[model samples]
Target: MFDWLYVLMKKLVENVFGLSLDTGIGDSVHFFFYDSVKIIILLGFMIFTISYIRSYFSPEKTKEYISKFNGISKNVMASFLGIVTPFCSCSSVPLFIGFVEGGIPLGVTFSFLITSPIVNEAAFAILWASFGWKIAVLYVVMGVVLGVVGGIIIDKRKLEKYVEEYVYEMQMNRPDIEELTFKDRINFAKSNTLEIIGRVWKYVLVGIAIGAAIHGWAPEAALTKYAGPGNPLAVLAATIIAVPLYSNALGTIPIAEALLMKGVGLGTAMAFMMATTALSFPEMVLLRKVIKPKLIANFVAITAIGIVFIGYMFNGIAHLVI
Candidate 1:
């Protein structure tokens, strides 16, 4: 019956909502809406389901689990939890706000914040399927390390003192955004499917637009000159250029692929890819609402430094072969 409801509701959504119902992009989905939508749908469901479970059970209890210690076990769990939360960089500030309000420890919440944007479902699925398992595994490892270390240091520094006073007052009187059962989880998934997609469709479209432009018109000579082999500074240049612009995984891969064909250094392209994924303009706009300018500045600096290191690592790795 629920399966029937799911299908029927999907049909209704297709007819009334006017989303493209064209089934399947047959693997090159980073370039097509049909494939992208499917990815979004699967991701939306996962987010909602996880949110529902966490909301219902640990929304309150997680504080205890985290606050008991500040060691490897906690940080490691924090890192892996980052993987499962599956939110986009755009969603980080809001998710951060929500988690803090729900009484989670600062370090744990920061772990989720760092990892979600740097690595996400869209990134993992597309990279693993397109690139290979090795790249995907390395991506996951790097993201987790960044998230865990960033979270722990921020915690040790007592940055909680820097949290906005307004947020404090709000957390004082927080209302119930609580747990749900099986049926409720379904409703939660459907609602989140729309909400998550709605917040991000603009970026997704922008990514696709940027990708298509790169695919069609990018100059081979331009790619080779500054961002090519023997250019150690290319990684840094890509990181600087990418931070101001936003391109989630879906959009950046096409451009990266184009650059790869143009003799651009893979390491430089990788830096740009990480920057666009983890530090986009849209993400900053959203974050500004939650974090004060000081905190945002700090967060940006820390994350950018991590990306730069990763960028150099990529360049070093490439030097080994190319």
Candidate 2:
């Protein structure tokens, strides 16, 4: 399907602009157009569909459903819920407070928090569009597993003591929202799709532009020499390096794809992506408004461990995908 689309795009570019797809610049242009179209279409459809489904599962409903589970099941459910639930880091702070005050386990809430940003829908769409179903599935599975493990680890540590007193004091009002009709749901989905597209399209273009430059002009040997699997610290270095940079997973997917093309280890690229999306320094600072320093440290430590594990595991089995 992609090849057919690429050929069609190539012919269109050639006929309309008199540009041959055989040259380096032409090839890059072809790549840019084909990937952009493919990703945009996929992203719009995915966000709209997910947003529609999400209308039926409000935060209140999510909390109610999650509160029913116990033991590991609770963590697992929380992790999965995080992926499907719609909330950014800022919104999550209030929700976190509400959950803790409402008797949701601190660990389970943490599970949701960890997975929510890490396995974002935009990132999922970009991964599926750029890589394929296999890589996309792998990313989601790893993200959910990390959330479950991280939550369980926090639960066992009894980290509730580290939660700030203000979190308990902060009250979230559950406003009575009218139930949405089918038309309302469709409109909501449409608005959400447009909003997401407007926000991320620039980032996508920037990322893909960088990717095209690297793919068309950069030196493969130089990249491989430092970032390849043979380099013992490559994955660790990438993860650590990515922690401070602020970027969404969707924006970074193109960069990761470029890195893979340049012979960077799959594990290294994935670790970098996970680190950027899951635990940036700014996100930690925002979280600090609700969680104590000790709890924040624990969150970073456990999440880092899981991300590193994912990195090494992918690098070790990279042949299967790369």
Candidate 3:
């Protein structure tokens, strides 16, 4: 789909810039320009389309819809809902409280919280654009599975006592759902696209710059030695390293692309991206408001274990996909 852009960037680098593609500096410049443009374009289009679809599913409607289901199916719905809602980890907290206030199960709410940041239209589109459909599909499947499994485990453990008492006592005033015309939906989509792009564009640039630097100057043998498929601890190392860093999936994909290019194992790169986006420290602080320390720790431990398992699973099957 973006073959033209690649050719154009190559031409611009070698011709307009008068730099040989053989040089590391030239190659890095090309990578920075090509990836930055491609991702930005994908971000704009996908965000708009997803935001349009999301206009129909307001918070009230989402809460009401999820409340109707029960048991495992409820968790399933919540996980799927999380994919379309497109909330960042910190942003998802208020809704998390709303779910509890609405009498939704802690486990089901966790399902939504877990998946909301990790899987979304932007992430899926970027993955498909950067890698391929197979990887994109696999990522979505794995993310949803993580959410469902995490939610179920939390529910089975009977962790409701960990929630703050004030959350239950707080009565949420339900707002009436507004009926939107097609025009309204379009306008909302446009605004949302701009808002999201404006907010994350810097992260995108910084991520791409890091990726370009790694792509252009990093020693492949060194990366392969530490992060390659041969290293059994590579995935675990990546996940642990990513815990302190925070970025959305969109920002992390380019870095993952560079890591893969530098001979890093696919699973290792993905684990880093997932850990950064899903279990960010800011998200923990936000959740601390409504839940106690024990619950937060459990959530982190459960989710981290799940991510590590997924990272290893992806490594095991890397050959089939790559």
- Please tell me which predicted candidate would have the highest lDDT against the true structure: 3
Candidates' C-alpha lDDT: 0.63, 0.85, 0.86
lDDT of 3 by residue, 1-322 (tens): 8999999999999989998778899889999999999888888888899899988877667788898998899999999888877476656667878899998999999998888888877677677767778998899888899999999999999999999998889887766667999999999999988987888888778879988888888999999999888898999988998888775556777888888888888888778777877898888888899999999998999999999999988888989998
The TM-score values for the models, in the order shown, are 0.65, 0.94, 0.93
By summed lDDT, the worst window of 10 consecutive residues in model 1 runs over 23-32
- Per-residue error for 314 in candidate 1, Å, reads 1.8
RMSD of each: 8.7, 1.8, 1.8
Among all windows of 10 consecutive residues in model 2, the one with the lowest summed lDDT is 244-253
Better of 1 and 2 by lDDT: 2
Off by over 4 Å in 3: none
Residue pair clashes in candidate 3: none
Cα lDDT of candidate 2 equals 0.85
Top-down lDDT ranking: 3, 2, 1
The CA lDDT at 100 in model 1 is 78
